[model samples]
Target: MRTKSPWLLFAAIFGASFLCWKLALEPHARSSGELERAPATAQVDVPPAPRATAPARADATPSAAPTEHALPPSKQRVRVVVRLAADASAVAALGAELLRVDERGREHAVACCNDPLAPAPVGPRELAELLRAQRALPEQREATQRFELAEGGRYAIAWHAWRHVPGTLTWRTARGAGEVFELRSPFTCEERTLELVIAPEQLSLDPALDAPVIDAVTHVTAKDG
Candidate 1:
């Protein structure tokens, strides 16, 4: 018999070692954590049904309708026309002409044209009396006597005469010694259009002009509705 070859001996030893590992070695070793526990079956939950929303109907009316009483349409514009004298002679002439104008002839005659000494209207009379008393005191007389015209003229007259002048109360221009015309309305009226005609160079400059006389005529306009 030939001696066993070295390779045959090595094969026998390796096969026996593998068989021992499979049976005895594997049974004795402790198991890893993953291998010992069975993999849990994957859990899946079913979702619930969604609720449905209703759509808007065509018959429903909206909440924002407008009311009936809106404001009246605006007027384009409103105005007052105040005219100053165009000519001093014309204004003076108007004062003279007032004596003949018949509308309120009696009132004008005594106060304006005929008698310069006639007493004034009741309210004006009281004022005149007060002024006369002041003038009699001497200190106030100089101031009461002379009134400067805007166009550089002065009238030196008794206090009672100035207080009784008719045109001064009614907003008229006095021409000479007879004429007086109403410049504007003293009542409530609406004029859609107004044309102011001022006389050429009639406006004057004198510091002594009475402010109350000018303001009562020119500044006030009737209030609007």
Candidate 2:
């Protein structure tokens, strides 16, 4: 066993210290190179866009127009008066009413025959013709007759024409002709006792006055031979 010298031990320790110092210096050099590189930039804020209120449209519905005729009533009553012209005139002259009232709450008239249940026309031509024929009838003549006023004497004219000619009649608000008639008759009788009365306003018993021509012909058909 030879004793080791202090100098040899010192040399060995110095070699180990040098190796640790080299390893520490290499890492510090790498960190210094990274720091020298470019620094990162900061980010900026941006606002969003606004949205639209109304979008593209495809289809839509339009409003409708108003009507002229009155709606059908729940309860309705029609009255007709047939009067010979003479009687109707007499009633009008005396300032007396043309309608008459009965005990059972029914109205009667001699000057004007009241038909409470008049029918309605199918179409415009039919309506005009109905009105034209009705107006031309003797009903108006009797409405002006008689000179006495009594109860149940409220009279009105109404008619229901079923048939109509295609090319014969037409109707317009201003001045066009058609077969549609506004079946509105005057009311002037009020008698409870009389069961039935036929007071056509006028008696146009003249044969010369041909049947008021409608569409160059009459609506009714001729009797078969």
* Candidate models: Cα lDDT each: 0.27, 0.28
Kindly list the per-residue Cα lDDT of model 2 for residues 34-127, writing each as its tens digit.
Answer: 8676544221111111221222111111112222335422221222222322332211101122233334545433232322221223222333
Off by over 4 Å in 2: 1-73, 85-201, 209-225
Residue-level lDDT tens digits of model 1 in 1-225? 246677677867998878888777575545786567653322111111122122111111112222233552222111212233333111211111112134444333223323223345423233334344434442211111111111211111111112122323322221122123232212122222222332323222222342244445455557732
Q: Pick the candidate with the highest lDDT.
A: 2
C-alpha lDDT of residue 44 in model 2:
16
Superposed Cα deviation of residue 28, candidate 2 (Å): 99
True-structure Cα RMSD, model 2: 43.5
